[model samples]
Target chain A: MSVTLINLFAVPNGKEDEFVKLWEAIKVDITKQPGFISGKFHKSLKPDSRFNFINVAVWENEEIYWKAFEKSAAPMKEKLHQMGVEMTPALFNVLFEY
Target chain B: MSVTLINLFAVPNGKEDEFVKLWEAIKVDITKQPGFISGKFHKSLKPDSRFNFINVAVWENEEIYWKAFEKSAAPMKEKLHQMGVEMTPALFNVLFEY
Candidate 1:
């Protein structure tokens, strides 16, 4: 089944711009990967929200999602870490919709 | 602008079904509220994910979202708490999409 990757990022207050720039750079490469369906990068309205940035992306399936992640996004972890942006990512399936 | 409500649910192990049941009950009323747009309930693929369930819902705007929440979903919070389900909900705007 197709999987949705929900990645929540805890970006330090002053690092929001840096985080967005890095994400834009990563997006350029990841979007071209196999099985990538669509994606939306969201910024929380409240500055103090625990996870200030959230990415909701869809992949064809779990295998392709992980493969693409390893190839394109995994290498960018060091830079994200340097920016003090922590990420909590997980794959999910749609349980219900309306 | 339209806002997305991303509510992450940390449901205790073994309470998945009960959590979902409560969510469905809330959904029926909330979906009928004014300004409701769309919603998707997602279940994490990994059993050990920190947030087992996530609800991504769109509303006409933040004001409408809060209004609907106060009218329909707020009352159910006690039940959710009793079920050992913790929620972290935040409103977000789409910064980028592809």
Candidate 2:
């Protein structure tokens, strides 16, 4: 089954632009990976939201999703850490929709 | 502009079914409200995920979203509290897509 990777990022207040730039750079590579289907990066309208940025991406399945992540995102761990960006990522199945 | 309402839910381990039932019940009313565009309820494939369930919904705009929430969800606050479901909701704009 296709899996949705929902990653919520707690980006520091002043590092929004930096975070986006890094995300865009990562996206360029990740989207070309084997199972990538689609993705959307969202910025919270409310500045005070605990998680200011969220990335929702669809991959063919769990294995492909992890493979893509390891290739595209794992290397950038240090950079993200330096920016003080905390990420909460997980694979989800669409339980219901409308 | 259309706004995405992404609400992450930290539901107790064994109460997953009960939580879904309540969410479905809320969906029945919320979907009929003006400006309601689309919605998806996602259940994490990993049971250990910090947020086990997420509700991603789109509305015409922030104003309409808050109004709909007040009308459809505010009343169920007590029930959700009893279920020990914690929610983190925020309205977001599409920053980029692919």
Candidate 3:
């Protein structure tokens, strides 16, 4: 079963461009890791939400997700934190699709 | 430009199956609407998360998303509420994909 990893972040005002550039680099680097299927980055349409950016990634399975997370996510998360972006991450098992 | 709608639900411990069934019906019904591209339902891999169920749908764009949401989502949300499922929804604009 493919698993999903959703990372939601809050970017400080006026730092959207810089944050996206950092994310772009992370995304490119992580694609080289095993089990990375696809990834999509999204920005909130609502202006008021504090945590407005979301990165949705699909992996081969739970184990693979953890492997990639440890190798790629750990460092990327640290970098984001250093840049002052806070992230909330959650993992999921896809049940049904239509 | 495609838009994504993510609905995160918190279902009572024993009602996951019932919630999925209701979601199945809603999914089938909503696919008949315009601008409904695709939908995926997922369950939390982490056992302790409060909001475990997620429905992710891709739409043509913001306007079309609103149209489908008003037609399908409004009623389905009401039904889910009646069934005691609490949902949090967010809309997003695709920024980058890889």
Top-DockQ candidate index: 1
Q: List model 1 lDDT by residue over B56-97, tens digit each.
A: 999999999999888877678888888888999999999999
Identify the CAPRI category of the predicted complex in candidate 2: high
Candidate 3: residue B60 lDDT (0-100): 88
In angstroms, the error of model 3 at B40 is 1.0
lDDT of 3: 0.83
| Candidate closer to the true structure by TM-score (higher is better), 2 or 3 | 2
- Error of model 3, residue A97, in angstroms: 1.2
How many steric overlaps are in each model, in order?
A: 0, 0, 0
Model 2, span A6-96: residue lDDT tens: 9999999999999999888988998889999999999999888999999999999999888887787877888999999999998999998
Off by over 4 Å in 2: none
By TM-score, rank the candidates, best first: 1, 2, 3
Docking class of 1: high
Residue pairs with clashing backbones, model 1: none
Stretches of candidate 3 off by over 4 Å are none
Full ranking by DockQ: 1, 2, 3
For A26-50, candidate 3 gives per-residue lDDT tens digits of 9888799898899889898885565
The CA lDDT of each predicted structure is 0.92, 0.92, 0.83
By DockQ, the better pick of 1 and 2 is: 1
Two-chain DockQ for each candidate model: 0.94, 0.92, 0.84
Q: Which 10-residue window in model 1 chain B sums to the lowest lDDT?
A: B69-78
